[model samples]
Target: MTPIGFVHSTRTDATDDAWDAEATTIHLDGDTFSPEALQGLDAFSHAVIVYWFDRVPPEKITTGARHPRGNESWPKVGIFAQRGKNRPNRIGVTTVRIVDVQNLSVTVEGLDAIDRTPVLDIKPYMLEFAPRGTVSQPQWSKELMSDYWRTIQSQ
Candidate 1:
C-alpha cells in the first residue's frame, strides 16, 4: 500500500516509552491529498493514526511468548498480548489529540512514531468505535504502561 503521508517530529530515535508530550506534524502528499481532503477533520478532537514501523528490522519480529520490555517481573505472553513494536506486521496505530488541521498537514499530540515514519492512514476517533464491554488486563501490563505517557524526570 502507498503511504499517504509522513510524520515530522522532534523524535528521531526509538524510545521504550514516554511519547505523550511529543508534538508531531503529519505532512500529507500534496500531490495525492489536497487541502480539501482535510476538510471537517478539524471538528474531531482526536484521530487514529496508522503508521508503518519502518525502523523495526525483520530480525526483531517475534511470534513466541516473551516478557514485556524484557522485564522478568512481567509474565511471558504471546506477541499479541503486548503492544510491543516487534511484531509480525510492523504496523503501529495510535490515537492522538488533534492540535490543528491545516491544508495537507495535521498537527497532533501524543503520537508515538518518530521522524519520517510512513503514515498509512488517518481516521477520526469516535466513541462508537471504542470497546463496548469491560476492558481487562493483567496487573503487570498496567505497571508496564504506568510511565508510558508520563514526563521523564531529570536527574
Candidate 2:
C-alpha cells in the first residue's frame, strides 16, 4: 500500500530505545491528501500510527524469535510475540500524543519511527477500542518494555 504521508523528525536512524521524548510532524502527501483529510484528527488526544520500516533490509527480517534484543534473560518466543522492528512484515505501530494538526501536517509525540518513515494509516485512539479485560504478559516482557517508551534524559 502507498503511504498516505511521511514522518519528519530529528531521528534519521532507528534507535533501540528512548525516542519518546521527541516530537514528529507527519506531512501528508499534498498531491493525494488535503487538509480536510486531517480536519477532525486534532480533536483526538492520541493517534495510532501504522508505519513502514522502509529502511530495514529483507535479510534482517525475523520470522522466529531469539531473546528480545538478544538478551538471554528474556525467553525466546515466536517473532509475533515481540514488538521489535525486525518482524517479517517490517511494519510498525505506535500510539502518539497529538500535539497539533495543521493544514496537511500533524505534529505528534512518542512515535518511535525515524524521519521519512512511510505512514500507512492513522487512527484516533478511542477508549471504546481498548482491551476490555486485564492484559497479562510474561515477567520478562515487562522488563523488556520498562524503558522502551521512556523519554531521553538530557545530561
Per-candidate TM-scores read: 0.95, 0.95
Cα miss at 111, model 2 (Å)? 0.2
Tell me, what's the RMSD of every candidate? 1.4, 1.2
Candidate achieving the largest lDDT: 1
Q: Model 2 residue 108 lDDT?
A: 93
lDDT for each residue of candidate 1 in 1-155, tens digit (9 for 90 to 100): 89999999988998867787677999999989789988999999999999999989999999899999999988999999998889899889999999999999999998999999999999999999999999998999999988787655521
Q: Global CA lDDT of candidate 1, please?
A: 0.91
Which regions of candidate 2 are displaced past 4 Å?
Answer: none
lDDT for 50 in candidate 1 is: 97
lDDT of each: 0.91, 0.90
